[model samples]
Target: MIKSCAVLGEQFVFRSLKEIMAKANEARSGDELARIAASSMKERMAAKQVLANLMLKEIREYPVLSPEQDDVSALIEEQVHEEIFKVIQNWTVADLREYVLEDQHEGADLLYIAKGLTSEMIAAVTKIMSNLDLIQAASKIEVKTTCQTTIGMKGVLASRAQPNHPSDNLAGMRASLYEALSYGIGDAVIGINPVIDTTENIYALLNETKSIIDEFQIPTQNCVLAHVTTQMRAIEKGASADLIFQSLAGTQAGNESFGISLSMLKEATALINEKGTAVGPHRWYFETGQGSELSAEAHYDIDQVTLEARCYGLARQFNPFLVNTVVGFIGPEYLYDSKQVTRAGLEDHFMGKMHGLPMGVDVCYTNHMNVDQNDMDNLSMLLGTAGVNFVIGVPMADDCMLNYQSLSYHDIATVRRILNQGPISIFKQWLEEYGIMENNRFTSKAGDPSIFMNGVLGGMK
Candidate 1:
């Protein structure tokens, strides 16, 4: 019975090969024949080489799996899937062609064999491919890994700290906070100031901070190093109530004396001019204290100049690059109307007024309120519209447990449902009809036989 089965298999193989050869011959062109022969030879050689190499490597790596060992053959058969994966890695058409043609052995196959490797093996191959600049690749990998790992979490805050002054002895803290209802971890480190601050203590703090960062090496991509003195000076000097508002126009007496001083404004402007350019790509938030006497309209007008000055200072310093500036309304009343402020309004008021600013510059009018989905969506849309290159915002933490009402997955499903019901739903229905969304999430373990069919054959239209 075994002999008869072997004979039948050989006959089937011969018939298939003959059919392929006959089809190639019927093409009736020298080029077609050459192409057919090359393809056929390449496929056969690749398969044979892959099979031989896998067997040899397996024997060397796992000597105990030798056929001589009891049940070893059965174990090997059981590991056929892994063996197939291993074989495919070094089974290149070029390697096969060279071997079949009796050419000198080249190590090309070994260099490119990575696709079927484990994650650790893949990392090793990537390290090799990066040509020893592994840190840069590692940094990129770390960022991607961290992002994926921490997806769907909330209230995760990250910031980079810099020295208060270049010459200051104390280090600055660059910190990130990931919070959950039950637990929280604050990743904080001190780092050296790349730029000098006005005070020597700030500078010292920066150096100390750098040492801390070097020691801890927290893996994060989003960071900021700011010079607060410059931002402070800019707000002080840029706009004064006496110049803009008539109510405090006199030799500002009593509580009205709360208006900005010229000397302070000058210092602020100089600080902004000096440091705004020096500190690169940071969300600089300026906190100010204005007396309660000022109306919302009056306060906004004055604050707008402060915002512009910081933006202009950075733009002037960078000369063609945009820097992100955020003005923080610190007091309770300052943020009282923030919920009413739309992203569109802020963009129109601030970003639109600034000419020749780098496209990435953003003015976040943040108050005490924690950022919500509406905030994120609006910001995302604005960033999309502006063609900004980078954005700094808090990413959700992984451990954040959410109530059903607050979950985004439900929102996605609802959007899908709405699409299903409306005339515009045709596109969504078409996607389902054509199985794009289903195919994307389809898994073989779930017993979706169509997944195997769609993969092996072209998927259904």
Candidate 2:
């Protein structure tokens, strides 16, 4: 029965071909042939209605939560409704029949129908259909509605953990971040720490880093770096900086404190500005990994708002010209916490105030906590939605590595046969076709040599 339904669905694609050809080959005047074609097309339309009703009925029998049944039914119904509506609203039967009979009809109708479907609809349908086998592979786990509601109410900390290994993770993260920056994916700010801790061999590292940045040639407005610090000088240096700074909740140790480390940053910014080789217009330097204290959080919030106001006070700063970048850090404890107040506070403040600055977070470092795969998935999706412009790619991270695999779908058959291969790769290929794959790169070879520039930066011109 299932096989028959599948066959029928496939048959629908070619159902009108025979009638179309018959009308084209009929021995009659053009007008008479067109009339006959219209009548025949009407009959075929009636049959399609029946087929649509049958498909919908079959769909209704399956549970709403059932993936296969719901997805197939939804897709069929959506297609049928769209096609029928176009026939009724725009095309005469003769026009459709003629288009159908021809080897090419320009594909305008198909494109129109495709555009009518929303992203949400496609995602929902894909999720339902793709998870069918997984549903069977894993035993069902049920949670009470109350429990689900409670989970939903919790903050970012209640979220799952990330991969272990700071260096490896940072590599992957840097890739993701680079990708995001290149493509203008979301809200992002790239922060650079220009000064290395030790003076012994710092010149090489700084030069290397600068060389890399120059090679990439990304817009200077999108990047900023912090200053170097010394143990005793750090305190005064941190306290004396003119710009406001913010950092992550929980993780600060010793001389690595958040608010008090600005003096060094000030020196760095001043030197870089004077040198004219540094990327600046630097108004802020966010401290990543500072343990959360209520006092600290409040101070952070006040400082951010105050800085924004100051920028505005200086010169229509509230307008679009004020270039600023806020660097944030995400770790296991923060992801696993039940109350994500710190994340929420920063989000609320920065989201509205920094109208034009690119904002992002670095998740390359390892947390001393456990994180699951699902957590990573959720975090990615969440950040994508939260106006996060760039994410450090998993493959670029030092810890988590990508397999650098590629798959080709040369035709419809290949697409239909895709089973466990996630749709992400398929979409990436589509993006590549349009030259939009920089941020969507799934494989290492997919990198584009051109530096990604944001539309906003271009708009400045």
Index of the highest-lDDT prediction = 2
Q: lDDT tens string, model 1, 1-461?
A: 00011121232121222122222211112213223222344333332222222322332233211235322123223323365356754443233223322323222232233223221122112211211222222111111002101210111121211212323323212221211100111111112222443444333333343333333332221212334343243224431100101011101121124344334434544544443322323222221222221332222111222223222322222222213333222222332233322322233222311222222222233324444456534543333333332222221211111110111212222222332311112222333443433432312222222332333212442
Whole-model alpha-carbon lDDT for candidate 2:
0.28
Q: Across residues 73-171, which tens digit of lDDT does each residue of candidate 2 receive?
A: 233233334544444333322332233224443223423432332212211111111122212211111111111011111111111111222332343
- Each model's TM-score? 0.28, 0.34
Worst 10 residues of 2 by lDDT: 143-152
lDDT of each: 0.26, 0.28
Q: What does each candidate score in C-alpha RMSD?
A: 29.7, 23.8
Give the backbone clash total of model 1.
Answer: 31
